[model samples]
Target: MNQSMFIVWRESVEALLVIGILQAWISQQSQSHRLSKFLWSGVLLGLLLSGLLALLIMFAGDAMSGALNEWFQAGMALIASLLMVQMVGWMHRHGRSLKQDLQRHADQHLARRGGLGLMLLALLAVSREGSETVVFLYGAGARLRGPELGLFAVGGLLGLVLSALTIVLLHSSRRFISWRRFFALSEAVLLMLGAALLVSASERIGGQLLAMNLPEWVYGSVGDALWDSSHWLNDSHGIGGFLAGFAGYRATPSALTLAVWLGYWLLIAGWLRQRREEPLPCLG
Candidate 1:
């Protein structure tokens, strides 16, 4: 539920930001009213397409069983993790100029094809964010069922509401929290979430491999726990469980899990260092 909520909140905020930028630019144009209509039409169409994608994923999951299902779930988790990392890196590189770039594209589209071009731009932008949200939610909540699934849905709705409120607050008063601060905090959380997803994918893959006729040493390394830490903080329940879900904390991790976790952070660290060396644009 928590994962679904965060994924929705983060992605919705980004989608809303894109719409806000386009709308703001439209308001400055001569045919503001007409352009606004086209923009909204595009947003609605994008949302509809995203809904279709969600349904498609749900049906596909329902159709699969046993090993195929496991493999599919693992693949989705891996894709989601990679997408999160890519999203964070892309945002870090382009966030400062996002507003300007959106406006520039809007101008070009309007000049080339008028309202139709603007509509297409909005459609593509919103659909990209929306499609990502669907995939992320499915990857995060694929194992949930019954009441847990209901809670997941509720969490997603809550996230959407919270995102709207957040946008309002940020636009109204940056004295409390600036856009830079918001993105920075969210980026940190996203990296942790990515780590958790990667761990999940690794565990699933490791389970499958361990079940195969592998050598004793390979089985020991892949399946055996290095050390037990449940006495300190059990990862199956309470706060520890939350940490496991949100940050990849494992009380009884195998060698594979540890390796994946460590590698993820190391890559992130190197990426951040490289980003820091490049001059950043002003976030005005």
Candidate 2:
């Protein structure tokens, strides 16, 4: 439930930011009334695209059975996880320039070609954010059902409402909340969520592998837990459960699960190092 809420909250803030940027630009223009309709239209269309994606994912999940379903879910989670990393990394590296870029695009579109250009710009921005939300939610939705599903829905709506409020507050008083730190924290939380999803994908994939009647050693490595800590820190209830949901905690994790979880961080560290070493375009 918390995972769903966080996912929705983070994604909502991002989507709202894009809409806010476009709307703010439109407000500054002379013929604001004319362009407002197109901006709203683009938003609705982007939302529709997201809705269709959600429906497609749900139907596709229902259509599959047995190992196929497991594999498909695993694939979706893995893709979502990768995309999360890309999203966070991209923002971390470019958040400083995002406002400028958006404003420049708005200027270009408003200057050269008018309504249609703005509409398309809005469409692409909203659609990109919406698509990311869909992927993130779908990955989280894999484990939810019944009343929990209701909570997920409620959580999503709440996230949207709360994120809008947050945006308003942040924009109204940027000094109170350091924008850089806010983004840095958001990115950190998002990366943690991504790692959780990666671990989850590994779980699903491991289940499929075990179902294939692999060798004894493979089964042992994938199925047998290194240690049991449920007695001390139960992962199904209390604070531990919350942490588990947030960070892919397990009372007794298999060797493969542990390896994958640890390996993901190592891989990310290496990638960050590589990115830092690369030369950047000269400002001069």
Candidate 3:
């Protein structure tokens, strides 16, 4: 449930940011109301795309039912995790410029295609996020069900509505949430979620490799339990469970899981530290 909530919250927040950027730009333009219509159209079309992607993934998963399917699923999980990490990194590096880029694109479209160009710009922007959300949610949902899934969906809906209201408030009164601060806060949480997904992917792959008749020592090395934290704080209840869902906390994680998780954080943290130390771009 926690995992689902975080996934929805993080993803919904991102989607809202995109919409907010477009909406803000439109407000400054000569034809602001047209922008709203284009925005809604893009949103509806993107949703349709998301639904189709979800169906395709389900059909594909159903087709692969044995060891091969497990391997495929594991591979997909790793891909999704890596994509998430890349996404968060990109957002950190470019979040400030994102609005400018969108506005520039919108202007270019207006010059070349008039009103139709606005629709295209909105469609492309929303559809990219929509497709990604569908894929990531499908992969994550595979790990949860029943009450947990319900909670996750609810959390996502809440995030979506809250974000939308925030935009409305900010636009109307200029007295609501500051997006820069919000992104800064959410970025760390999103990164942690990415790490959890990576760990889960690695473990799933290890299990598949073992079942495929790989040598006992090889699989054993990958699966060897590093430590058990279930006694101290179980992962199915309270704070531990939330951490487990959001950050891939395992009671008895394998040596590989521990190694990969540690390595990922070290690399990301070091890169960010380096970026911080670097001089700002010269304006001359």
Scored by TM-score, the top model is 1
Model 3: pairs clashing at backbone N, Cα or C within 3 Å: none
Q: Provide the lDDT at 191 for model 3.
A: 75
Candidate 2 residue lDDT tens string, 63-138? 9998889889999999989998999777756676777788799889877888877887888888888888888888
Compose the digit string of candidate 1's lDDT tens values, residues 1-284. 78888999999999999999999899899999999999999999999999999899889988999878888889998998999999988887898899999899999999999999999999999999998898888888887899989999999999999899989988999899778888888889999999999999898888888879988988987899999999999998889988998989999999999999999999999989988865443345
For model 2, the stretches where C-alpha displacement exceeds 4 angstroms are 273-284
Candidate achieving higher TM-score, 1 or 3: 1
The true-versus-predicted C-alpha distance at residue 174 of model 2, in Å, is 3.3
What is the lDDT for 106 in model 2? 80
What is the overall TM-score of model 3 with all chains considered together?
0.87
Best-to-worst order by lDDT is: 1, 2, 3
Runs in model 3 deviating more than 4 A are 27-35, 166-177, 278-284
Q: Positional deviation of 258 in candidate 1, in angstroms?
A: 0.7
Q: Tell me model 3's lDDT, rounded to 2 decimals.
A: 0.73
Model 1 worst lDDT run, 10 consecutive residues: 275-284
Each model's TM-score, in the order given? 0.96, 0.93, 0.87
Q: What is the C-alpha RMSD of each candidate to the true structure, in Å?
A: 1.4, 3.1, 3.5
